[model samples]
Target: MSRERRKHVVYITKNSEYHCRDRECVAVRDRRSGEWLREHSALRGRLIGAVTAQGRLLRRMRIVVGMRLCLEGAGDEQLVMTSVVRNVGRPKKSATCAYAYQSWAGVIGA
Candidate 1:
């Protein structure tokens, strides 16, 4: 028996973390649609847009102290927010890498 080869692509970005909603973003896609929806039941009456995971692959990315991410929401409003990842686990075979920058510094180490 032979195994299929997996295709790999590298994504370049200065930051890794994205300020998207928990349920309304590409983080959770319903099985039925096979499409990412920009809706969240957790946030009632509040509207937000979906962040596509398709284009969000960042490899070997490091997060700085003051990195900002444009979070998309309802009315197409973009909220500039900063964040930091306190801890990261070892990358799995299916896991991807990410980069980030902040006021402190930038990291090339994923």
Candidate 2:
């Protein structure tokens, strides 16, 4: 028997800034995207924390403004900050689906 690969929901930020609110919480914002990920929102704070932690771990640097980040994961599973690039010119296509968030919340009972 073979194990199936987990599918992750990708969230791509455009010219975003990652703010570590505290040791356990994090928030991300973009001028165009507004406040998509917030510590106090229905979305799990640990998810944001995991993104920041993994980004730092993989890139060995702090996330700064004007940096584009790709956050991928689902539910309470281990999230991954797949890409962290600076000054990449044009914004990539948005991969985050609003309906997905709603469906996740429904399934998880947010």
Candidate 3:
């Protein structure tokens, strides 16, 4: 059976880390409901964000980060849906294309 997709309020920080906490600024507040982008705001240009995912897709994504997600279990667990990212960190020096692709694929069967 295909898992139903769920939208998550993900914030991909400059460190390429995932943080679901309220920025305590306009990025979180000001919105009536649901996560979205604000122009010329705290969420602008930091990184691509606010994605939706399914359970299996979420699990596979968690595997990619070696499950090194910085979230509190139980409480924050339900808040976030899923994610997949490389820790190349900052992108000043890009991970080699081969390595980057391999890194992502390496987590698939784990």
Best by TM-score: 2
Model 1 score (lDDT): 0.27
Write the residue-wise lDDT of candidate 1 on 8-98 in tens digits.
Answer: 2211123332222231221212335432223422211111222223434232233222222223333445442223332222322332222
C-alpha RMSD values across all candidates? 16.7, 14.2, 16.0
lDDT of 3: 0.28
lDDT at position 75, candidate 2: 58
Error at 41, model 3, angstroms: 16
lDDT of 2 at 7: 31
Best by lDDT: 2
Q: Against the true structure, candidate 2 has what lDDT?
A: 0.36
Error (Å) of candidate 2 at residue 5 is 40
TM-score for each predicted model, relative to the true structure? 0.21, 0.29, 0.19
Which has the better lDDT: candidate 1, or candidate 3?
3
Q: Give the higher-TM-score candidate: 1 or 2.
A: 2
Question: Which ranking of candidates, highest lDDT first?
Answer: 2, 3, 1
Find the number of clashing residue pairs for candidate 1. Answer: 10
Residue 91 CA displacement from its true place in model 1, Å: 8.1
